[model samples]
Target: MIKIYSITVTTILLAVVSLISCSSEETSEKKQENLSTSPATANYAITPVDLRYVKLTDDFWLPVVKRVQEETIPYAIKKCEEEGRLHNFLIASGEMEGSVKGKMPFDDTDVYKIIEGASMTLISAPNPELEKELDRIITIIGKGQEDDGYLTTWRTINPKKPPAPWVNVVEGKRWESLTASHELYNAGHLYEAAYAHYKATGKTNFLNIAYKNADLIVKTFGDNEGQIAAVPGHQIIETGLIKLYALSGKEEYLKMARYFLDNRGRSEHHKLNDSYLSAAYSQDHLPVIEQDEVLGHAVRAMYMYAAMTDIAVLMKDADYENAVDKLWQNMVEKKIYLTGGLGARHEGEAFGDNYEL
Candidate 1:
């Protein structure tokens, strides 16, 4: 009887050990499965930048590009042709605040925005036949391109090159500022469109056009003599320039982008107390990171921060990434409304407060 009881105890111990070993093996397999699916674990499926860029380009940006291309840009051009104003660049319509004026006798800058927007359309919705139409549109936008590679309707129409004065100094005035002006804005958009075009269809023409545009920008502006210190009202140029750099594998473009980004934070223009204050207001204050909340000019802030994050993530800068992370977190988690509305009130075109969503 004692031997039988001992044998039973030994059998139970052996079975328990075997059961534990099996459980351990299963747990290891499960971990492997989990790692495979982990979004942040970085498999070949996608990266954060890719998703973010797509979200911005596909969902948010594509519609606006389509609307402007089909609706706004052509309408503006037709109006110009009808008014015999086709030679001059069309000032953007709707209420653009009293202070945000144009180069007048107009410039060709915005047509690229429309063109780039249209290019993005082809990217999001690839229609091979549509490429021909896009090519036509590009030609139209490029119609004003100068022999020296300069692309601006204002210069074509209003030759003083009537320096872009309002950039980076005022709230409502930034759009009129050079660097912060429409021309660079157009370049930025074109660069983005070029990137989308390449991503969507593996073509290089779109990227080439934008690259030439950047080269023109680099030649025209900078610390060089006769060049002003101001930048564009929008922030996309920095990222756009960076993209162009990567596209071409040229270091100059990256330097240009870095220069623009660094300039924004150095606190020079804002302290000038110059007429550009309105333009600076247009850019929504300096010290990009110190901006505790996402405030006025919803669209502008979104682009600026998004590009900033792209640069940060690509470069692996911890401080920049942390700031971007905080801002993005705030925008998505605390401030976004249920309808996908961002800013609660469009009055200032700014955000109200967190949780007000």
Candidate 2:
């Protein structure tokens, strides 16, 4: 029972807007926003995905895989795999933790679970060396973990755990928690990664480890009263856990995820505790899909809905999927930008309407 006290008083309002008008040509008044550095864009066209057989990968799975494996996970895995390395690699090896040229040093134990997950994508990616990195990455998670199955590089190093401390930390350079708390997102990612890895190689070790960690998360967060409401900052875990439930015949995972989804934006859990912290994170502040106009964080919103869709499918909940379908319709038909980027403004790093980006 995670309760976000911050946003309980601030009600989230929902309204349905008409979908974007159909048009053939790009708006003529467009300014050339320099996207030379953007990831290579494919035509944004996609056939309607039938999840029954094709196995609905996350909509952003491919781009996320490309970024995580080639860019983020390799460097992180290298540091994590090194002999007796203490910092989060999900740490950079031989790279200065305090310098400019090194990899982003995120040496927290809770965070590495994400690196493990990001590395997990190699199991599904097109690259062979990436596929090879999965086992080595898991080994790093195994080595760095505490005996209680607690593994977060940050917490491991900074032993004095603060309640919701992650939500408030701001570095001189950037939002530390944006990426750090993202580990939960990473954990969800890892869960997906482990499932993909295990299926790719017929090895249950990866998923088995995920089940262990997820059980811990579920146990601790299961039904505590004075905590945050709302959902995970990253949404993929819901889908990941749902997939796990579908495969393992486990109702517990689905139940826990349902708890996460149901409490989101509701006043039920947050009225007692640190609810205002909800302002620091947005997914906690609104009902899924009811926020028709995408607000708050971008990555968090999409992943959350993606997970919502997954659960809706598994339980055959038309209401949830209808919400997902509405939002999906909005994004595909109205909100998405030209390069397939969801959020246009980097400030909130969130979605803008079609042609608005």
Candidate 3:
């Protein structure tokens, strides 16, 4: 049995705070001083207090946070390098050789996520050494990116031979199979990590990489003549783009985010037929606004819900808000495990029959 972590609600709460804090106009003037950038002026439903304003002095959450900063962050970085997570980036950049060295197509995200976590730690506690280490990782990531801003190491290294045989390799081209390729999923993590780095250190290196890639995403996908009207097989990119929009005040990023969410489950959008690519597995069985049940990969559902909540408040769309509320009730009332562990079934890392846990 998969040992699931009991942090689903906590993750959503943190994401909600991160997203809502920026768009909230009611953030007090005193809180604004601690923010890396001025609190966004966009109208939102809940204005979360800035992390800098909220200190975790309590014995419970404080040590947990510090352990991540003091112990987990260092250990993870070492393992990533030792295990070739960092070297894949180097190999993709021609700094090394041989085939991809990871089990998953999206292992690059491990590095990005680690940096994101460390950056978040820096936000609460100033750590120059940790910040510098993150800079080193981001620099390597930038080197691995393709000229047009694509950054998936496996595809870039050998698209014809994906790390996993299950990934459909079509002419070794980028964006060929959005459903299983996980290209967008990697970018979503990159954007999240880069934005965190920016917030933590005021550095633009990683953020610029994200911006370039995001711009390409906006350029590549849309309802226009040449674009692909497709949604991600996995979610989280929508919320990531939304966060970028909140930070940069760029309407296009917000539009692309909304586009991804709106296009899900529509015949007009791309579809997949693989065993795991089914609509329900990826939360694409229905339009997000019409989705009531939190079906699919549990983490994907959480990310989508976070984005939906953001849309509800940012766009003031009552329908989206209502949909999210219904989904929340469904999870809390029926699906959630007693230990707060979600995704009870490890088969697809997905939700199970109501109250199966």
Per-model TM values vs. the true structure:
0.62, 0.60, 0.87
Off by over 4 Å in 1: 1-110, 117-128, 159-176, 201-203, 220-227, 269-284, 353-357
Q: How many clashes in each structure?
A: 29, 32, 0
Q: Which candidate is the best by TM-score?
A: 3
Candidate 2 or 3, higher TM-score?
3
**Which sections of candidate 3 miss by over 4 Å?**
1-28, 32-41, 55-67
Which 10 consecutive residues of model 3 have the lowest summed lDDT?
1-10
Off by over 4 Å in 2: 1-86, 89-133, 161-183, 224-230, 271-281, 353-355
Q: CA lDDT of 62 in candidate 1? A: 48
Candidate 2 lDDT tens digits, 293-322? 555567677667766655565566766766
Residue range 1-357, candidate 3, lDDT tens digits:
111111234344554545533323345674655443432323532344444343344455556777887889999999998888999888899988878888788899999999887887765567788888888888899889989888899988988878876788768888877777889999999988887788767889999999999999999999899987788877889878887886788989988988888888786567654434677888888888899898888988888888777777667778887888888888888999777788879888889988788
RMSD of each: 16.3, 13.7, 5.6
Model 1 over residues 136-221: C-alpha lDDT tens digits? 55655455455556555544443334435443433432224453345666677678667656755576766767777788777755
Score residue 265 of candidate 3 by CA lDDT: 72
